[model samples]
Each structure stands twice: as structure tokens, then as C-alpha cells.
Target: MHAEGADAADDARAALLAATGAATLDDAVIIARGRPRLDGGEPAGPVWKVRSTRGLDQEVSRLAKSRGVSKSQILREAAAAYVEAS
Candidate 1:
């Protein structure tokens, strides 16, 4: 690695360790973006991706209009339906 790149990585590691040690439990977890699932339900399954924004918007809008719902809500429901179908 380049000297500057190595230095930057070292700096980032040092900062992370410092934050983990200095933070409260909740704050530290939040800082690390760590979300631990509980036993009341199974862990969330793997997330899928939508490739094209335009296609996604069109589909969501169509579903929303058919369902008489808002576009954003329709998008979410469509995604959930897809996951279930898969």
C-alpha cells in the first residue's frame, strides 16, 4: 500500500477503538452500525437489490395505483411481497 494510504487506515483504526471504548453501550453499538436481532423472532433474512431506479419507480407507481395506496407505501409492500414470493 502507499504510505499515505497506510497512515489513513491506521488513523481510522485508532479512532474506532477509541470510540468503542469511550462510548456508552447503546452509543457504541450505534456508532458501529451494529444491530443484533433478538430471539422473539428469527434474524432478518438477506437483503435483495433493485437494479434500475426507473423500473422500480414505474412498478411501484403501478402497484400503488392498483391498490389505492401511496407510491412509497406501495413500493414497500411490493418489496415485501417479492421477498415472501421468493
Candidate 2:
């Protein structure tokens, strides 16, 4: 590779190493949970994606099934509860 290409590859490797200090996905989640809010300030609008693992998805599905509610309803209620609490 060219000298600039080599340097870019090294930088990318260093960034990935820094990002994955924890060895497991669960550890990464814990690290992520500890991070400060990334919004910089209050968000400008309401629409956003909420991320979760398969484990959480299964639990939410179970709750929805038992409660006779749709998955959307469960997710919406969860988001509403979080918004109200914060």
C-alpha cells in the first residue's frame, strides 16, 4: 500500500481497538449505558430509533402476548414511560 493508505489503515485499526476494549457484547452494553447523553442538548423532534438486543425483544414480545397488546403498543408504552420519568 501507499504510505498514506498504510497510515489510514493503522488509524482505523487503532479506532476499532479503542472502541472494543470490552471483550463481550454485554460488556459493551454496560459501557454504553455509562456514556453521557449524546444528544448535545434536547432533541429537536420526537421520532427516533430505539435499539435493543434479541433478549429484550423476546421479553417485550412475551409481555405483549400476556397483556394482549401489540408489540408496537409495548414499545410505545416503554418509550412513554421513559419520557415521563426523565
Candidate 3:
């Protein structure tokens, strides 16, 4: 490989390692319970994508299962609670 090619390869390796450190997908979930990281896009939040699935997983699913309410009910309750608290 040319000198430029070698440098590009090194840069790519470093980027991959950075991405790995940024997000680790295990058991279909991205763990983001710590400090936020700003990357090439919008600021990363506590929202962890369900990598094992094709679409987003609503938090209400787990909240509902745990709280004995439907997903919609959980969302409504959460919105109300947030509005009241704020």
C-alpha cells in the first residue's frame, strides 16, 4: 500500500475502535447509562437502540410490563407526570 493508503487504514482502524468504545451492543441493547458523547451527528442520549430488531423499541413496553399498564397508558402517565413535575 502507498503511504497515504497506510495512513488512511490507520485512521479507519482508530475510528472503528472509537465507535466500539462509543457503543457496545450486547443482548440487542446499546448501553448508554453514562456521560454523553458528541459524535458526527446529534448528541447521544440515554436512548439505546435495539440493534437486534429492525425498528425502535418503545420504553413503555418495559414500563408497562413492570407497572401492569398498557404501553399507551404508560406513555400518557409518563407525560402527565413529567408535565406535573416540570
Candidate 4:
């Protein structure tokens, strides 16, 4: 079992090195450690939850689809613009 785990780790490290063009195992490890958590371990940044009408949600979704971006991206851009204009 330990050998299997080690092999999996080795495979992941090799794949990471290849994908990132890292020259060393240390570099690959650093890159892996730098990735943000997506499993609810810890957030990479501030997260906000807002309440909106269904119409607003649909509009945001429509805008996101038309702009070829995620709904979150649309909301983030809108927030940034509001801040800049303030």
C-alpha cells in the first residue's frame, strides 16, 4: 500500500513537472503546495454570498454566457467597476 501511494505521488509530481516545465522536484512540489484549496480546507481569498432576485440571477447568467465568462467573473467585474466609479 505504501509503495502504491509513493507511485501515485511520483506520477503526480512527474505530471506537474511536465505541465509546468519545472526543472526540479523541489520546484514541482512548490507549485503543488501553492495551489489554492478547492475541498473546503481553506479559502484562497474572501468569499461573499449575496441575495438577489431570480430575474437578476437570470440576467447575470445570460450576460456570462454571452460574454463567454463565468457568472462569478461577471459579478466580480461589476463589483470592481462600482468600486472604481465610487
The number of the candidate with the highest TM-score is 4
Quote the RMSD, in angstroms, for model 1. Answer: 12.9
Candidate 3 Cα misplacement greater than 4 A, ranges: 1-58
**Compared with the true structure, what per-residue lDDT tens digits does model 1 show for residues 1-86?**
99999999778767875755423444444546643453357976565565668977788767654444456455566677999999
lDDT of 2 by residue, 1-86 (tens): 99999999778656554564544445544544553433576554465578889999999988765554456667877878999999
lDDT of each candidate versus the true structure: 0.61, 0.65, 0.50, 0.74
Question: Judged by lDDT relative to the true structure, which candidate is superior, 2 or 3?
Answer: 2
TM accuracy, model 2? 0.42
lDDT of 3 at 68: 41
TM-score of each: 0.33, 0.42, 0.31, 0.49
Mark the 10 consecutive residues where model 1 has the least summed lDDT: 22-31
Which residues of candidate 2, in runs, are more than 4 Å off?
1-49
What would the per-residue lDDT of candidate 3 be over residues 1-86, giving only the tens digit for each residue? 99999999778756654644432233112322322244556765354333423232355566554444444455556667999999
